[model samples]
Target: MTGKLTAQPGKREELADILLQAAEGMKDNADCELYLVNVSEDDPDAIWVMELWRSAEAHTNSLKDPAAIALIQQARPLIAAIEPVKLRPVGGKGF
Candidate 1:
């Protein structure tokens, strides 16, 4: 999954930090193949996240994880807008 998140004004860096923390935590989940957080060069408020899961179920299950839920709660208030895009991997270098 790929998502574009816009932070609430000056909260972009704060949101990115939380996401990076989430990325570190994701390392423990075997089903979580990848979790990458990126920033847009031109847009200070833009945060892009790329995630790859072993299965759709794994992705769904991650939302229920306590740590993930906590991170979500932290990020929620900082988010001004979010555009989520789902993608199926045909072939990828990371996977």
Candidate 2:
């Protein structure tokens, strides 16, 4: 899943940092295949997160993780909007 998140005007960097922390926590989860966070070159407030999980269930269950839940709570106030793009992977270099 690819997620586009717009942060409050001045909170982009902070939100990115929090997201990185959350990704770091995911390192311990075997189901998390890949997690990458990128900032938009044109818009400082825009951030993108790319995630690949072992399965849809794993992705859904990740939302219930304590660390992920805490990160979501912390990020909620700074986030303006969330746009998710779901994709099906056929084959990938990393995978």
Candidate 3:
């Protein structure tokens, strides 16, 4: 899934850091194929995250994981809004 989120003013970096931590935590999760984060060049408060999961069920179950929950809790307050982007993966070089 692809998502764009706006951080609370002045908290973009903190949000990115938390996402990076989440990426680290996902390293051992076989269900998670990708957990990529990028900051928007135009919007200072905007950060984008791209995720590739083995399945929808896998992604849902991940939300209940303690480590994932902790990261979400840390990031919740810093997030102003989250907008999901509709995209499908066919094939890619890095992917």
On the 0 to 100 scale, the lDDT of residue 11 in model 2 is 99
Error of 1 at 17 (Å): 0.4
Clashing residue pairs in candidate 1 (N, C-alpha, C atoms within 3 angstroms): none
Which lDDT value does model 3 have at 52? 93
lDDT of each: 0.96, 0.94, 0.94
Model 1: per-residue Cα lDDT over 19-66, one tens digit each: 999999999999999999999999989999999999999999999999
Name the top lDDT candidate: 1
Instruction: Give the alpha carbon lDDT tens digit for every residue of 1-95 in model 3.
Output: 99999999999999999999999989999999999999999999999999999898999999999988989999999999999986778988976
Cα lDDT of candidate 1 equals 0.96
TM-score of 3: 0.94
Off by over 4 Å in 2: none
lDDT of 2 by residue, 19-76 (tens): 9998899899999988999999999899999999999999999999888898999999
CA lDDT for candidate 3: 0.94
Q: How many backbone overlaps does candidate 1 show?
A: 0
